[model samples]
Target: MAGNSDPLTPRAKLAVTAGKAVAAASRAAGRGSGSVIGGRVALKLDPDLLARLAQNLDVVLVSATNGKTTTTRLIAEALRAAGPVVSNALGANMPAGITSALAGSSEARYGVIEVDEKYLAGVARDTDPKCIALLNLSRDQLDRAAETRMLAENWREGLAGSKAVIVANADDPLVVWAASSSPNVIWVAAGQMWKDDAWSCPSCGGVMQRPGDDWFCGECGFRRPTPSWALSGDHVLDPHGSAWPIHLQLPGRANKANAASSAAVAAVFGVPPQVALERMYQVQAVAGRYDVVQFEGRDLRLLLAKNPAGWLETFSLIDPPPTPVILSVNARGADGTDTSWLWDVDYTRLTGHPICVIGDRKLDLAVRLEVANQQFQVCENLDQAVQLCPPGRIEVIANYTAFQDLRRRVGN
Candidate 1:
């Protein structure tokens, strides 16, 4: 008997098969493989399998160093406000994870995905998104990303010759430069007082200045058209939290940026500003990013700090005369085996002291803290650290793996 062989159908079958195989492989790696694939049998499908599942679904691919998840979710919600939408909301940003998401959806008019920077180009090539939202580029995951410039170049190559409308953050110098070469790009400028990192020519190494939230190359005079949609104001009255009101469900400057990016993406999809505001107010923080929890009669804040950029943003948001904190770091291969990026973080900002250092890499954290003149108690075990630390308004910083372990330990 001959094996099943129909070109299009077989391709579709292969996609399904590969997807299931990926999930199984992830489980075998000791990761929570089910969160995204969720009880789906192994099929080992390929990208073509998605074609069999649906047709004419608009794809929105969102990529950035930070804010991808929130922006993707907000955009998905805004699209959902218009009609039914499907997304991989489980922080699965790679090609396989995206395939799994498409496989699981029943009916979807639009598909919004948060893509990893390294995978963005390939995903874009394969998925052919209708719109690609490129948020600000920042230094993140040095071990993986290597450099922001390289990632930007990869994005440029990935997007070349594609008909996808480019929605970009104009204030980011790298994004501005990348979009300058592309026609049909819609720029979105950050609001007032938004301090962007890419303020100069990425190629010429000249200072790039923002004159009125619109970026222009000071030296080369390379400039892109200002954003069609811009988010500006003192306060947006986010019910989740307010800077002026001085209360936030998620505490940090980064959160504000995340919210702003979300709003911008929502606006691009024709969501009414008023409706966007209302929906944003109802927005809740995700599990690992500045999620406040009440555990054991104590208030605990879980802030995900995966890389140096994240660390800087987290540190900037924290108010200090020395708040008690639990800092966790891990150097496992799966959790970013390289820890050299620690040097890029300005640990001095966390001046006063940490209450405890938890995780397998406690000594490394302790040494870094002590070197920065910040006192800390080291605990090799996460459970021990949690038990020993007193409750009440505690801040916990954890890397990807450590964050997951801590969440499980705290039952969050």
Candidate 2:
């Protein structure tokens, strides 16, 4: 239970009251997740609910095609040193989730919220966050988001009028363009692993040059901006080239980049980069991501891989050589309902690892793995799939829905 000290008007209070009742009922009935419907009801009652609720609050907005949820959690954890930070803790980035978060803890003066890629500008306008962290952009849920550049273009328009200081990833070409015109910006050289969505310049359609870690366009002047903070090997280097060790519980180079970005944002509030990183290390999991749940009498480390880029980064975290992993792929609506992106990813990395595939889209994944010449066996059911693995610390990677289903199954 959180403190209650809302400054809302009588009408807004009534709307929120009704919304909470609906959310409680939804949770009791188990009809939906309750995050969206509660927000929907609140918005239906008061369309300007978020704008009104955001008054006098210090808010931070985190948006990206991937890692937004975990990044939001890290930033929120860091912000807690200052005071209580309200956020959508269930990995909900939509308006409803933000509403539920704000309405749930109206007393908190600080908020660390995750905004979906498409709705960043609008949410920023309404909530008017004190800082907006722009993480990397790649092809994710393209059926709903369209071209990856369109999101960057929207950010350009949406962030033009933003008064908040911008903390953006300079390593990503698309993010560089998105934060180009913004007046106040803190650039971080967080790595971009996926280059499929960045073949051409978003500005002039010119071929992008990847000389080394950064990128530049031949026709357009667009290029990776000089970063204020950058990841050097296993360390995060400041402008003075001083190295700070990134010892986070979240594994992989991508999480190091996320912690670096979070530290950059925390620095704006006078939190030392070292202090911020220390707090981030306390975070072992974001939602169900990176959780080691006991399932079917074996410890399963859960990895959420929603798209090609997500799979690439998540897979890199697994220990090298003979790593046994459970690969589940589901083409649910939340996962963009298209399994075609499976081909875009180079699954040959799993050649040495023992692979067991499951889920509704297991056949599609099996076909992909077979063509990639990876040795793997298919299991018809997840329960039976767990029995196939050795009884020990087995690693499990799944797409959006499959991951959530497993999380619920394991009671995480």
Off by over 4 Å in 2: 1-7
Q: lDDT per residue, candidate 2, 1-412, as tens digits?
A: 1234555888888778888888889999986568788888998888889887887578899999889999998998887887777888787789987887788885576888999989998999899788999998888775666788888999999999578989999888888888887889989999899889888998899999998886899997788878999887778887777888888888888898898899889887767777777888889888878888888788889999888899999878886757688899888789887678899989998878888999999999999999999988999877787888787878899989898888878888
Give the per-residue lDDT of model 1 (tens digit) for 1-412.
Answer: 1122332466666656556666777788887755356323322434355434434467788998767876776677667776678888878776656767776665677788888888888777767677888877776655666677777777777787778778787667777666555566766654322244565577677877766646667787777565555544434332223322212255555555555555555655666545655565545676456677777676788888777767777776664745677889988765667676676677777767456888878777777777777767888776566677665677888888888888887777
Which is the leading candidate under TM-score?
A: 2
The weakest ten consecutive residues by lDDT in model 1 span 238-247
Candidate 1 regions exceeding 4 Å error are 1-31, 35-44, 50-54, 191-200, 207-218, 223-225, 233-250, 319-322
Q: Give the Å shift of residue 160 in candidate 1.
A: 2.7
Q: What would you estimate as the lDDT of candidate 2?
A: 0.86
Clashing pairs in 2: none
